[model samples]
Target: MKLLIRNLSRATTEAELQAMFESFGAVQSCNLVKDKTTNKSKGFGFVQMVKNGEAKAAMKTLNGKDVDGFKIRVKRAEDKPTEQPLQDAE
Candidate 1:
C-alpha cells in the first residue's frame, strides 16, 4: 500500500522516515519529496509498505505523531484522476 506522509520536518531524512515505518513492518520503498532547484526536502514524502495491514497500522500510529518537532500526517495515497483533452464544439 502506498501512504502519503505530510507535515514532516525539513530536517527529516528518507532513512529516518523508513526506520519509523520499518518498526511496523517491511517497507517496500521510502521517498522524500525535494525541491528541484535547492534539492531540499519539501516537508512531505511517500512510503510504500509491502502489506496493507502494516500500512494501516503505521498510518494509525504515525498520523498526527510528532517527529522532528513537527506533527506528521499519514494516509493512503489516492490515485490522481486522468486528465481529459478538450474537444471543439459541434
Candidate 2:
C-alpha cells in the first residue's frame, strides 16, 4: 500500500522516514519529493509499504505527529488521474 505524507519537515530525510516506518513493518520505498531547481525536499513525501495493514497502522501512528520539528500528515495515497492522449490537430 502507498501512503502520502505531508507537511514534512524541511530537514526530513528518506533514511529517517524509512527508519521511522520500520517500527511498523517492511517499507518498500520512501521518497521525499524534491525541488527540481534546488534539489531540496518539498516538505512532503510518499511511502510504499509491503502490506496495506502496515500502511494503515503507520498512518494512524504518524499523522499529526511531530517529526523533526514539523507536524506530519499521513494518509492512504489517492489514485492519480490518468492523462488523456492528445489528438492530432490538423
TM-score of each candidate? 0.94, 0.90
Candidate 1 regions off by >4 Å?
none
lDDT of 2 by residue, 1-90 (tens): 999999988888999989989899999999999999999999999999998898889999999998978899999999898999999999
Q: How well does candidate 1 score on lDDT at residue 58?
A: 100
lDDT of 1 by residue, 1-90 (tens): 999999999999999999999999999999999999999999999999999999999999999999978999999999888998989999
Looking at model 1, the pairs that clash are none
Error of 1 at 26 (Å): 1.2
Give lDDT per model, in order.
Answer: 0.98, 0.92
RMSD of 2: 2.0
